[model samples]
Target: MRIIGIDPGTGILGFGVIDAKQGGYRLVTAGVIKTPAHTPLDERLAEIFDGLTEIIAETKPEVMSIEKLFFARNVTTAISVAHARGVAMLTGHKAGLVISEYTPLQIKQTLTGYGKADKKQIQEMVRLNLGLSQVPKPDDCADALAAAITHAATTRLGVV
Candidate 1:
């Protein structure tokens, strides 16, 4: 199965694609869609939508595994993230992909055997799990790949 994992944000939406098989997982591609810092929110969202839509088309992923929006201390940031998240889901749905949502805790636990694992720990696991020589660059990109890895593990174990 081909899976596209998304880490949504208005300014920097990260995306990773992986081919998951019974044998193992293979990284297809991973990167981020970055809008300028001062860009208007609506324009940034459009950029995200366009970029993700193109990615889905190019990669042709069968499923989408995305991190669910969560924020305890920053309502302002959370609201913008919510918009990005919504756009991501809509793109997946329109593309006819099987959409899956996973909490950050679930992703971290699936990758590192600890729900509260630090970003570095999870990124290291992502590299090890996929047999990469180095961790994926940019924290957002690694987080997106982690989401994909979590989905692969979950499905392989019959949990998804």
Candidate 2:
């Protein structure tokens, strides 16, 4: 199965694609969609939507695993991220892909066997899980890969 993971953000949206099979998972691609900070909000959202739509078309993923919104502070930032997340979800839905959402805690727990694992730990786990030589660059990209890994693990265990 091919899965696309997304870490949605207004300024920088991260995405990773992985191919999972009976034996293991392989990285297909990983990258980010960045929008200029000075751009208008609507334009940024349009860019996100278009970028994600193009990604879904190219990857042809069977499913999408996206991070759920979890903001404890900064409502202004949270609202913008939520809008980006909505666009990402809409793109996936329009592409006829099954979409799953996981919280940061859930992703960390699944990848590192600890719900409160640090960023380094999650990045390390993702690297090892995918047999990558080094941790994926940029925090957002790694986080996106973690989301995909979380879904693959949970699906295998019949928990998702």
- lDDT for 104 in candidate 2 is 94
> TM-score for each prediction?
0.98, 0.98
The per-model lDDT (C-alpha) reads 0.93, 0.94
Q: What TM-score does prediction 1 earn?
A: 0.98
Q: Compose the digit string of candidate 2's lDDT tens values, residues 1-160.
A: 9999999999999999999998989999999999999999999999999998888888899999999999998999999999999999999999999999999999988987889899999999999999999999888999999999989999999998
Candidate 2 structure lDDT: 0.94
Q: Pull out the clashing pairs in model 2.
A: none
lDDT per residue for candidate 1 within 1-160, as digits (tens), equals 9999999888889999999998899999999999999988889989998999999999999999999987999999999999999999999999999999999999989998899899999999989988999999888999999999889999999998
Off by over 4 Å in 2: none
Q: In angstroms, give how far residue 7 of model 1 lies from its true place.
A: 0.6
Per-candidate Cα RMSD to the true structure, in Å, reads 0.7, 0.7
Residue pairs in candidate 1 whose N, alpha carbon or C atoms collide under 3 angstroms: none
